[model samples]
Target: MLIAFFTNNYKPFVGGVPIAIENTARMLRRRGHRVLIFAPDYDGDVQDEPDVFRVLSIKNFNNTPFSLPLPLTLRPAYDLDTLSQVDVVHVHHPFLLGMSGLQLARAYNLPVVFTYHTQYEKYIHYLPFPQQMTAELAIRLSTRFANSCDAVIAPSSDIRKTLIERGVQVPVHVLPTGVDLQKFRGGQKDFLRKKFNLSAETQIVLTVSRLAKEKNISFLIRAFVRLCTYNSQAVFVLVGRGDAEDDLKALARDLGIANRVYFAGELVGKELVSAYKGADVFVFASTTETQGLVVLESMACGVPPVVVDAPGVRDFVHPGVNGFMVPEDGEADFAERVLTLLDDEALRKALGAEALKTARRWSLRQTTSKLERIYKSLSAKGQPRGKRERFIMLRELISYQFEKLLEEVDKLF
Candidate 1:
């Protein structure tokens, strides 16, 4: 089987979507399937890789301070020809590249699948208009995009429910991104501790995510300040960098927890695994994740998370079993739960054990099998019905035009 993945962002750009595309494509290739990635070129930093296609792209709208990659189009002559040869199309995002993926599927008479990766409404602040206006626009556009796809992959059942609630007519599949358990099983924490100059008796609390507003890092810092009052020996280490780094650092200093907080800026490979293993507890307050891959990574390393009760991470936390899931508004509760895990050694070990057991169910090997089955199922369905396909193509065209109008209006406002 030949699979073509369409993503707005790729390698060298830090985010969950790129990682998902890379991991799935890698595993699919190992499973004897030909895989290709169609992504936007960012600052000439991306290198030529086997089966990967990078198109010349530019960043227009200064939407966010993160310098996000916003591609112009995917209709280049060569790209069209390359896309025409694919057996299946899997799109990671549902706005720009997503519209292109749907159009390509129509042109090639192939099945197009979309993975609903982010909660669009939660990110409307990037636009200039009032969030309410942009949020309504986001939901309408998202629903139309999902409806046009042959199938929509929701990383969690909660997201699937949201799609159904928003009137998505297509089939929604619950398939979260997978974690490589083997990578975490053997990673030693001592090396990381020594490198960071942490004392053997000090406790570590970690949150691995892009330092962005939607990630709710500010809320976590405030909660960490409260947590420090209970346990001064604990260190809060934030992994990954983004536009919010300076503000987060300043906030930590203002809160007088700067000495207790460590910004360990994006550790990959064994170092990342070691950071997870060395931590006594993983802490997260992001309520906007489609699927919290870092939560599974933390659990895979036997460091259970005390996360806010959000859709994706909610699927992983089973309270007293694996980890605790605090409610969205429960900042105090979130801090208390982290303190609870920190104060009790036996309880932390028990929860961590359960977390590892739960992590096995989401191993990359098992999730890849599920993805393969989805691919085969789409292949088996063959091209979409002729009349229905034409209607879908027409609807998508109109929807794309309408979305562009909305975007223009947003810019004007």
Candidate 2:
């Protein structure tokens, strides 16, 4: 089957969404299916992936890592013969290039499958409009887009429930981006000894996330400070960079644990694997994730995480079996859980072994096969969406594009 993916994020841009797209595309290709990606050009250089069609884009929009694609540039690609034969359209976002893909799917009369990848309402700080207004609009617009599709892929059961509450009438499947288990499980590395001049006896606690406010990173740091009060050898390491880095660093200094905290900004490839494997415990406080890919990665490396009890994280963790889940309101309890693992060698090793076993259940091969089945089932259907439904979807998408154009013009003046 020929499957096409339209996303606002892709390669050369390292983030959760791009990583998910890359993993899904690679796994599908390995399964004897053809996949094409329509994405924004990040570097304006020669294309690395032959199957990807680059749409003209504004790199690093509003000083953020995301690229703003010029949707008009995508029309010429639609004229290509190869694209015309695509069996299904998998859209990874609800706006921008997502709308362009919907237009393409409609013209070709193909099945459209939309994935709910992020909690857009949580990122309203990136928008120029008023917070409440933009957030409400985001929720409403995303729900309308989901309803416009033939089927929706929710990364977690929590997201599916939210969609139903918002009146999404289409078929909703709870499917998440799976972890590449081998990437971390292949080997072990003592990153703490190599990066810092720390001994093997030192207790290492690690967390990987963009140092953004929405991630609740400050909460993690405060919890880490509490752990430091009791364990002198325990050190906290953060493995990502974002706009809030300076503020977070200041917070650490104010709390007097500056020396105990290490900021390992933006690790990728082997460095990331080493960080996950070397740590005694993995900690996460983000409440906005659609799924906990990083937490799963940590588990694959045999690290047990004590994560904040939230919708996405709960799907992967079994309280006594693999990891601990602290309630969102229990910050002190969160620290206590991590301290429990850090101080006890036997219990930590027991949970760490179980974590690797748990991670295997959500491996890439398993998840991609499920995606293939869904595509085949959807493609077997006899007809496209109703004519009236297609017309309404197109009209709404065009109006959205026009409004975005006006905003770009308004910014120029």
The clash numbers for all candidates, in the given order, read 0, 0
lDDT of 1 by residue, 1-413 (tens): 88888787778788888888888888888889998777777664458898777766654335443234334544552456766667788988776666676777777778878899988899887777677756876787778778777888999999999999999987899999998777786777875568678899899989999999889999889988889888978989999998899999999999999988999998888888888888999988888989999999999988878999989887878999999998888878989999999999999999999999889999888899998887778767544622123334356557766987999999998
**Model 2, span 248-274: residue lDDT tens:** 999999999989889988888888898
Those runs of model 2 whose alpha carbons end farther than 4 Å from true positions after fitting are 43-47, 77-79, 384-413
TM-score of every prediction relative to native:
0.90, 0.92
For residue 50, what is the lDDT in candidate 2?
65
- C-alpha lDDT score of every prediction, in listed order: 0.82, 0.85
Best by lDDT: 2
